[model samples]
Target: MTELTGYQHGLVLGKFYPPHAGHHHLVRTAKERCARLTVLVCAASVESVPLADRVRWMREVHPDVTVVGAVDDVPMDLGDPDIWDAHMAVFRSAVPERVDAVFSSEAYGAELGRRFGAASECVDPGRTAYPVSATAVRKDPVGCWEFLSPPVRAALTRRVVVVGAESTGTTTLARALAEHYRRRGGIWASTGCVPEYGREFSEEKLAELRRARPWAHWSEVTFGTDDFPLIAQRQNELEERAARLGSPVLFCDTDSFATTVWHERYLGGRNPRVEEIADRVDHQLWLLTDHTGVPFEDDGLRDGEELRPWMTDRFRAELTRTGRRFLTMSGPPATRLAAAVEAVDDLLGRGWDFAPPLPERR
Candidate 1:
């Protein structure tokens, strides 16, 4: 290892379960005191948040700090001597550079500093400075939203999924809500929407199939239960990607649950994997767009103009059956959009307080 000349290097280590304002302040404090700082993000397999995600959050806040992940499958136990030794080795390996000082906000810094032959500097040991903990943040992320960064906030944001049958304007309302929140500024500047992945995939398939066979029609494309699992997975992937991009409140065009409904209708029953994915997706609200006399245009893929009411009822039945929170929407596009915007605003306003009868679901 290369030895530095005169500059003093500091080491700050923590699980950073999800880096919050308290951790941010601790890192900033260390940076101000030392010429160079290296933050060791220790992650265990049993942690709720992934190691890669925690490292990303640390880097986002303190880019200049030498952020490194100390990933280990070993259980974390400060009480056991063997556990401490394993952790110390993990830390040392992560940062080979000689640590001139150890910075932390806990009593453990002293012992860790001794192992490195460095001074232990505790910042805000009393927790009075930031008055928060990782445990508190985990319990209620929204309650502690003010202290969290954009990436973390986005992860914790509640999703309001828009679902409907043909010509019910799910995409229109989704786009409108996304745009409104994004332009509204403040924390919502990070808000955006996940476009329907199923439609995009179908469009691509149509183009490719049509080029190969001139007689190919949209209805000719037979979709099986297997196709929907990929669709559901892709939809979630897009939603998660949007959230990382800073969209705290994502307006989803459709979610896995709605896809499951389609699966049941077309394939006789929902695929096991699709059902599992749907069950796992955490949606705060399901905005069901009603077919209120809207003229259905031939979208090529949608031979489902006749399938509107049936599909809509199927969607409603699924929501009701699963005991999921939902709101029923009817009227002109503008009216539906207005209602959706209002519901979302209320949803955000109350910090995701859903006491039912918000907009009334059929």
Candidate 2:
């Protein structure tokens, strides 16, 4: 074993409700000063965030340290010995090994060390490095977006996908929405727009056919039953990547959900595998661009003007059948953009409703 200079085994315990930068800093400090550190994530049943999610976030952020979680329903009371005993029982059950050092930034650190008969080590009790808490994060996640990890950001992001028939301005609207948000500056400047992967796949297929046949037209390129699933899967992957790197709101030209409709349009039936892939990721809103009066530009890869009305109705039907929230956009370009902005603003205004934690015992 390596020579030990500091505490043999250290312990850091907290609710870690959503695991912010402060929690990560504490874990990093504890890990640096001790040979082995165990982070005990105790969550109550009343909390909206699950214990398993908190444990996973901690483990992902700090892979070197040991992370464990336990359902701690016991109400908190610092002065009451009975409540302290009850809470300690839960903590001890999760971490049965001997603890030589107890690290924390809260006022209860000394008492916790005394109860464990270990040295109490405090790091940045002033919260100077990362001035953030679970309560603050829960209240305004957008304001605290920078302090969160990528996984947490991806989970919290509001994904909006624009779906419509050929030449219905879905791409234009998606790009406009992204630009509109990006102009807001600050966190919004990093707003992302995920383009349709299926479109790219189509272009690639056509290009390959042209390379071989040279005289083959876009209509000659064919799609198999298996192709729809791959398109849907790739669309989801692109959306996920953009969500992790972008701001709280992510706009998509089209998504996996739209791929299922395309599958029906081309293959003349439904693909269960494509539907399953679409169901994996959650999208907040779907803006359906109306094909009415919108000129269908063949774009070389498009099917024709006659199919637009059928495709639009199919998308609306499927969206309703699936119970996904959606809005239909029509009229001039400016009018459609204004309506879309209003809907998105309303969605953002609602905010994340994290259930309040159990109150401290009086």
Per-candidate TM-scores read 0.70, 0.95
* Model 2 C-alpha lDDT per residue in residues 235-320, reported as the tens digit of each score: 99988889989999999999998999999999899999999999999899999999998887888998768989999999999999
In angstroms, how far off is 271's CA in candidate 1?
Answer: 0.5
Task: Note the residue pairs that clash in candidate 1.
Answer: 190-247
Tens digit per residue, CA lDDT, model 1, 242-265: 776654588899988888887876
Model 1 stretches with alpha carbons more than 4 Å out: 5-17, 21-101, 105-118, 122-151, 352-362
| Over 4 Å off, model 2 | 1-5
Please give the lDDT score at residue 152 for candidate 2. 84
